[model samples]
Structures are given as structure tokens and as C-alpha cells.
Target: MIVKNEERSLERCLQSVQGKVGEIIIVDTGSTDQTKEIARRYTDRIYDFEWIGDFSAARNYALEFASSDYILHLDADETLEDPNNELMGNLDKDFYYIRIKNDLGTGLVLTHQFVRLFRNSPEIRYKGALHEQVQLDHNIHQYGYLSTLILHDGYKDDIIKSKQKAQRNEHILLEEIKNNPTAFNYYNLGMQYIVAGQYNDALNALKKSYTLANNYTFSQKVVLEIMKCLHELGRYQEAVKVSMDAVELYENIPDFWYQLGLSYLEWGMLKDAEDSFNKCLEIGEEKSQELLNHYDGTGSYLAQGQLAKVNLMLGNNEQALEYILSAAKAAPNVTGFFNIFLSILPNASPKELLQHVIHIWPYQTERHANLIATLYQQRHPLLNEFITYHNLDVEYPISTLHYIFENNYERALAELNQQSQKGTDHFITNNVILLSFLLNNPNLISEFKNDISLSEKEAKWFKNIILKKVPTQSIHVNKALLMIWKQLILDLIQLQKYEFIDLLISATKQAEFRLIISECLQQYGFDELALEVLIECDNSHVNRQVYMTAAKSLIKLGAAEDALFYLSKAEGVHLDFNVLFEKWRIASTIDKFEEIKILQKMIQSYPESRWAKRTSGAILG
Candidate 1:
């Protein structure tokens, strides 16, 4: 057992590995903290090693003091999750290799048991500067990569400190790469850049590593990094091409299939995308088959969620909802499940989705409050009543924004004053709350202007968020209210009603305003006016919704092909009215029959929905 300044994780590691190993040799590499003191409780065979840049040197030095025949190394940050008989039984094996599992999250875990335990011999030494692996002779054989996984929680917070450690190792790896230019070294560098959010640097380094990789062993790792980098850069076309190339190289790897499917989806190749995602499900872990029950079963929350996202992107809301529901069932406590839950209700009331979110993740009240407030301001049906009756803790800055949105200026001001005076640096939160205050009650700014010490840039940033009413500014949105406001804004704008200037001003700043306005114009049965807004926006949320709405209006105008064109552009919004529009277009050709049944079904199912009810009534009439 090797230990250092890991007082944060030492006791947990020791408790897990205790009683299993015969001899414990903890090497303290200059711990300024109480790490060595804690190490004394476990074993007296603690040795001090001076701080050196070489991790291999310190680890190898610890091995010299070990008296056991088979040495099992344990990092202070890593723990043996199941200290059962299977793990204890495996220790007696003569093989140098042992399986390792990384218990990354509480429920969502992946196993990658590497050979960590081995006989203490000169040939078996540690390699690499960072994420070092055990080097063994060619004659040595590996044990099974079993189910016993190590829980690694060291990646928590401390990002700046971690980057500092990586920067030093990156310099050392660069020197090694200069001499040998090995595939592994470059791959490591790319991973480091990826963690650091240096997308361009990661891509360049990964591309170079792919060129240098001569071994199949490192090929999968290379492909994963390249695909991830391309995805981050939004180069979906090239990403899909590269992922296909990887699948051709190694078809068995499940991650490659997952990436291939995701990239194809990103590139809007839906049928091919669905096929790729299904292949990923087929190639899933054999042991995890019971957990996966669907044709697109990803066996994990993330994979299921990804499938839902793809289905949602293709305008298959029912399928998307199915995948997301499966994910929620698999992992009820996860926040990611709510992401898909909220998205599926693109046309649902914000209050409805917010209730669902808070119901699943009850502890996430802050998130719920924000969402509730957003819905209220967007004029989602009865969102104002929901907040007033529910008595949700609106002390938070965003909650105050919602209060202001409802014209409860007194309560909103009170919340802001309390938050601002708390002396806590609420930069982002404060900025958003103040922006709402400015929009709802401009006079309040003059009253609090002396108290608020905002920089020119910060003020400008706040102004942008306030003007755009971008969802980024605040999480709370009333879907119904937003839809209604969107309709009214479009009506007022197209009808040239200057009386709704305040409404237009409030919405003009929001990212989705133009799209909402465009849709309203089309819903009022004005295709040309809606198209004018479509020409301005490039696939933004409201833009896509409006474009789809435009298709319906075009069909009404007896332009069937033009309606189909708009429907094609409504890919990202996940709009479902395209099929209905098509049916209506065909009906228009006959001029004898109306597909009012479809419209009635939609309106009956979603009565509060403007689009559904309007289209349904129009067909009925």
C-alpha cells in the first residue's frame, strides 16, 4: 500500500484493502499534511521518499521495502469496492496480472481491470510520467479482467491543481515524444488537452497520434479521442467520416459504434444513425445484457440518454420519450435524466415539465425554482398560480426573476436586496436577477444602481442576457406562457401594433424571440411574414419551430412542395406537424375532404397547445 498527502482519501482506501494483503508498505513522498500520521494507524512499514518529478522512481523505491511474494499497489485515492472472497482468492494466483475496475460514479460504472498486482522483480517496473502502467516481461501472463472495480473519486473539484500537475507531466511527455514520437505519448497529451478544454489542441495532437499509431493496442483509444474532439468542435461531417473509418479498423469496440451513431445523428443522417446506435446496443457488454432490454438498449443511463437525444433530433418525440423514460427507470436520481425529460416536452407547458423534474429529483429544488420562474414569465398556462400556491422558496436570485416576470415587483426586489447584501460573490446569479429587474422594473435599477458595483463589460454582458432573454440567462421558463407571448409578439409585429412594444422589447433580447414571432405570423395564417424571420435565423430553437409552423401555413396557401421544403428544415426543433401538413396538402388537392380527425386528436390530447388547437380548428372549419 503506497500513500502520500491523501488524508482526504487514505482511510477509505486502507479500510477497503485491509485484512486482504499480508504486508502493507506505505511510501510517504514528503506529505506536509497529516497523511503520514494516518498511515501509522494502518502499518508501521512506512518509508519517506523525497519529492521527485519521476513517479516511477518513487513507486519502484517503495517496492524495495516490500517483503511479500506478490505486491498489490493501492493508491490513496483508489479503493477496493467489494472486499469479498473473490478478490481475496485471486491474490494467491501466480500470474503477475490482476484486473482493475474504476468505480467512476455511484451507479454508472465501467470496468477496465488492468494488471496492477504482480511479483516484485526487476523486469516488472512502472512506466510513463502520468497514468503510469506496470511493465512486465513478455513471458508474464495476465489474469482475467474481472468485475472487481476500483472506485476513483480523485477527479472531484481541484481542477486548477490537477491542470498544474498535468502541465509538468506534459513537458516531460513532450521530451519523450520528441525522441520517439510514440503513439501513447501523443494520445496522453491529447487527453490532457481534452480535459483542459483545449479542443483545437486536442484535435491536432490526436490527428498526429493517429498518423503515428502503428499498434492495434492503442488504436481504440486514438479513435475515441479523435471522435470526441471532432464532436466538440462541431465538425460533424468529418467526425462521422472518421468514426466510420474507425469502425472499419476495429468493428468490435462498442465505443466506436456509439460514436459512429452519434456523429451520423449530428450530421442529420437519421436512418443510418438509428442503425449505428442499434449496432452499439448489439455490441454492448455480454454481462450487462440483462440490464439492457430494448433494441437500442445502451445498458447505461448516458447511452440511453444519447439515443433519446438522437430520436428527439429526428422529430421522433415518442421514441425519444421512451428512451428517456427507460433511462429514468434505470437511474432515478441522476440529473441527466431530467435533461431528456425537459426536452421531450418542447411543446408542453413549462409548469408540467418542472413538476416532473422536481418529482424525480426532489432535492434539486433550485433547478425547479428556476424552471418554474421561466415558465411563469414565458406566460405558460397557470405557471404564476403554481408558484403562488406551491410556495416554492423564491429566495434564490432566479426565483426573484420569476417573481418580477409575474409583476410581483415588491417580492422580487426583496429577494434581490437580500441576495446582494449577503456579501457572497453572486456574479452570474446577481447579473441575471438585476437584468430581470431592469426589464420588469427599470426604476428599481436607479434605486439599487449605487449598491451594484458592475464593471462595463459585466454590465454589457448582463444587458445582452436581459435583451435576448436567452434561456442561458435564467433556467426557469413557462413553455405555455412563452408560446403565448411568442404568438402575441408575432401578431403585434406583423399587424404593426406599436402598443405591444414592451412585450416585443422583453422578447427581442431572448434567443428564441424571433422564432416565436415568426411562428405566430404563420399561425395567424401569414406564410410570407413567417418566412421573413426564417431567412434571418439559422436553425435556432424558435427559428426551427417557426419554420415548421411556416410549412403548415404554406400548405394552407395551396403550396404543397414549398411546405415540404420548410418541413425538411425543421429537423432540430423535433417538430411533428410535417406529416399532418403533408396530409392537409393532399386534402387541399381534392378540396372535398378535410383530415380534421387528426387535428381533433391532437387538440384533444393537448388542449392548451396553441399550434395543435389552431390547426385542428382550422381543419374542422
Candidate 2:
């Protein structure tokens, strides 16, 4: 196996392949750490290569360094499972098979396979910079699945390595796109954006790729990326279209069918969604049909597991449940299959389901917080179960806020106060924001005031998002914040809290929010009151609403020419009649009969609307 920067897992990897291969070769590519030192202990023919941007290049270089007729490559982050026994048993097999476990950052494991142990001939070489794959010249013969699996432990921590790598890769792809603009390069750039969590960029690149792609080589990939982007952007209908297009392109690929089913599920297309899921079940069953033909061999249980997943997505809880149980029974020792089985639910009691999940996957504590929320949604009394099973010492403030929203404020308050006693950082401040706005318990502002330390950025974020509803001392709470606070104050007037209005004007200490408060007063039938605030605005930097509000107020005050001046600032005659009413009033006062006729005609066009009635009254009066 070739290796680099593998000091953390090199020993386990080397020991796993021990006695399996006749010859061992270690290819190190520019290791600055103790990786080379540890690798030297395992093999005498340790070779080095200069680091290059292309992954396939490094992999091919490593392949050339190997002396054995067959080559098997493994990453530094992986360990061979039960390597000694499994390797010895499958050494002379006709076809190569490798078990790969995706150790994504969240600690979830998805196992797949690759044909890594292949003949060292020119017919096979690696391709692609990222997600490198071995290109085979001929069809596969007989293949064997090893009982042992590879343990991938790469993504234990949230690392910057992948993002840093993507930053460099995106540049290379940009250059390639300039010259070639191939569907494959765009698809690669899109995938890199996905890896870096840049969903918008991912969508742009993937959409361009999809439009340009005319062939199958990159069609499936382009469709999948576009579907994922639409899903992330909350365009569910668009996502469904992409998924359907993919299903039409590749009718047999179970993944595309499953995605189509999920899109339908999200859009509440229950019957059609279930049919799509059923297609996945049928296709997935056929995927594992070969196992039954070869009685002595293991089949692709992963595909079958996915079939169960699609069924679950379709809400066919019973049928999905059966598939998982049968799959687990077929491969009893596969822990991943058991976990999938535990996830199955029919019309089963919530308590029973939670009990089964916890009983079977007792060691899987990572999902406890999520399961707690899910159980609560199902109206299951699993709070104690969650706290006990997961040892969740941290307060889930957002979850508490949700509870308060459900009229469970007493319970929310209890959790928040308990967390405060524990002195956990950021617990009190976030809870206070939720309590003040969602629970409408202004007392939390005072209760948690001294305890909460709001940073300038955090304060600005809260002011922008949440405090618009509160709109009181939160200004003092987030000073030096420069967002225009006018409309926000106007919203407070609609909320009808006169005390909040006074507090807003006082806190702003500037004329901006006062002008907005004036608009609010006009909306509240206090047009005369609104005019006073408009006068304070300097009439220069105020927004469209400020002029509209001033026009309406001036019309109410019978200052027709002033109203006309303000109404003239409005861009078009097709504006809402609250503003047009002022314009019509001014036109009649000035005896501009033509403009008045046009305004009257507009009112007549929409006679039933409130704006029309106001316009007609202004014109006649």
C-alpha cells in the first residue's frame, strides 16, 4: 500500500496487509512529518515522489514504484479490518475488491467498494484530480467480498485541509474551463463547491455544466449536482425536474430514482413519490440478485439497504420496515445494516421505536440529541431517555425556544434557568433572545442582562434578525450598528405598542427611525401625528416610504401642494392608491384636470380595492 502523512495510522495499516502480499512497497510523496520514518520500519524499498496538484498523477507514480504484479492502494486515514485473515483468504482471487468506509466529519459511516487490487498492467491507471478512480480495460471476472472491512477514520475533526485543497483546485478548474469549458471540468468545479459548502457557486457551475452536457459521461453527475443545488436553495419543484430528467437519462441507476422519490415526497406528491421509490426497490433488488445466483458469495447489501431508505422516504413505513429487517437477517453481523434496521418505523408506537433504536444501537450516542427532537415531535415522552442515554449536559437553547413556541414555556424556562446555573457560555444570552421575542417575556431581558455578554458582531446579528420585534433597549444593546432602522420602527407602530414607539424614538437619538415611526402613525390613522415625525427627517436621505408617508400625512392635513411635492417623488402613477389618493387630492386642489382624470380612471379600474375607495374619496373631496 502507498502512503503519505500516515504516522497516525501507518502501523495499523501496515500490520493489516502483513503476510497478504509477497512484496511490500511504500511510496512516500513529500512527507515533512514522521510518516516517512514510521514507513521505513515496514519496508526497505521506500520511494519518494515530488508533490503535484493532480491526485491521479501521484497515484500512477506510486503504482509504477510497486514491484508486485498486483497493486492495492490505501489512504493514510484507513485501516484494513481483520487484515491478516481476510487478506490471506482473498490474496489469489481472480478479481479485486476493496471495502471503503466514508468517515465523514459527522461520524456517520457509509461503506462502499472499489477494484483496487488489480494487475499492474498499462490497461489500468487512475483518473480525476479529486475522487480518483481506476480505469479498467476489460470486464470483470469473478469477484469476492471480504468479511473484513476497511475502517476509515479521516474525518474525526472539522479540518481546513479539504477547503484549502478545494481553494487551489477551483483555480485549476477555472483555468481549464477558460480553454476547454468541458462538461467534466464544470462538474468537477461544482463538486468542489459542494465540498466547500458553497451551495450557490455549486448551483451556478452545475447548471452551466448541465446545459452544455450532451452525452452520458457527465450527464448523471450534472443532473445529481443540479438536483442537490435546487434542493439546498429550497426550489423543490426545480429539484424534482432535475431528478426526473436524471431518471429519464439513467433508468437503472437506483440513486437517481431514489432522489426523484425524495423530491416528490418533499412536494407532497405522495402517490407518484411512492411509485418512484418502488422503482428503486425493484432496481435495488435486482442489484443484489447476483448473490442468490452465487450461493457462496456475498451480494451488494448496500443497494438493498438503499432500497429500504427510499421506501422510508415515501412514507411506506411498513414495507420499508420489512426490507430493512430482512436485510439485517440476511447479513446479521453487519452493524451498519442493524443501524439501518433500527431507523425503520411503521405505525409503531413512538416509545417502542425509540426503545428499539436505543436497545440495538446503544453505543451510537451521537444521534441522541436529534432523536430527542424527533421523539418529541412524535409526542413521545423520551426527554428523560434522551438526557440519560446521551448525557447531554449542554442546554439546547434553540430546542428550548421551540418548546416555548408550543406553549411549553414553563418547561423552557426551567431548562434555561438550569443551564444558567451550570454557567455554560452563550446559553443565557441566546435563551434570553428567544424568551423575549418568542415567549414575549420581557422580564428575561432584565433577568439575564448582567449575565449575557453580547459581542459587537453578535449584537449586530441579533439586532438585524430578532430585536426588530422587541425594539426597545436592544438599541443600547447593539450600539454602533449602522443598519437603517426606519422601517423596523414603523413595524413596531403596526404592533401597536405606543411605549415601544416612544422607546424607539428615544433610543435612535437620530431622525431616521422617527421618520419611520411617523409612517407607522399614518398607517394607524394618526396622519397628523405622522407629519410631525416626517418634518424631523431633513427629507433628503429618507426612503420611498418616508415620502409616501409624508404625502399621505400632508393630504390628511389638507396641505395639497406639499402633498403633491411628496407624491411627485413617487416613480409612477401605477403606485398603490394610498399614495395615489394624495396625488389625486393634490391634482384636484391644483385643478390639473387631465392628471385628475387619469387618477380617477385608475380608481375606477379597481373599484373594490381599499386603495381605489381612498382614491375616489380624495378625488371627489
- Per-residue CA lDDT of model 2 for 179-219, tens digit only, reads 77777778889978887778999999988887887563456
TM-score, every prediction: 0.69, 0.53
Query: What is residue 309's positional error in candidate 2, in angstroms?
Result: 11
Per-residue lDDT value at 227 in model 2: 79
Model 1 spans > 4 angstroms off:
1-4, 90-111, 156-163, 287-300, 346-409, 421-440, 447-502, 505-513, 516-562, 565-621
- Alpha-carbon error at 525 in model 2, in Å? 40
| lDDT value for model 2 | 0.59
| Model 1: per-residue Cα lDDT over 1-621, one tens digit each | 555567888888888877777778888877888898888898899998886766777888888887777777778878875545455664544343334443333234434445666766666778775657776544555443335556665543363365266677677777767776777778878877876788899888887887886464555676677887898889876787788777787676566767777776665455456677667667664523222111122435556777888777655789898888777766664455655565576445546655665555454455555445444333343354456656755446546545644656677667667776664433323433334434444344345554555444434443454445433343233464354345445323432443443434443434455556656565444566666554434436655666666766676677777776766667445534434444444554654345565556444533323445665567666
Point out where model 2 deviates above 4 Å.
Answer: 1-4, 7-12, 81-99, 105-113, 121-136, 139-163, 172-186, 199-219, 285-354, 364-381, 389-444, 450-621
Q: Would you list the C-alpha lDDT of every candidate in the order shown?
A: 0.60, 0.59
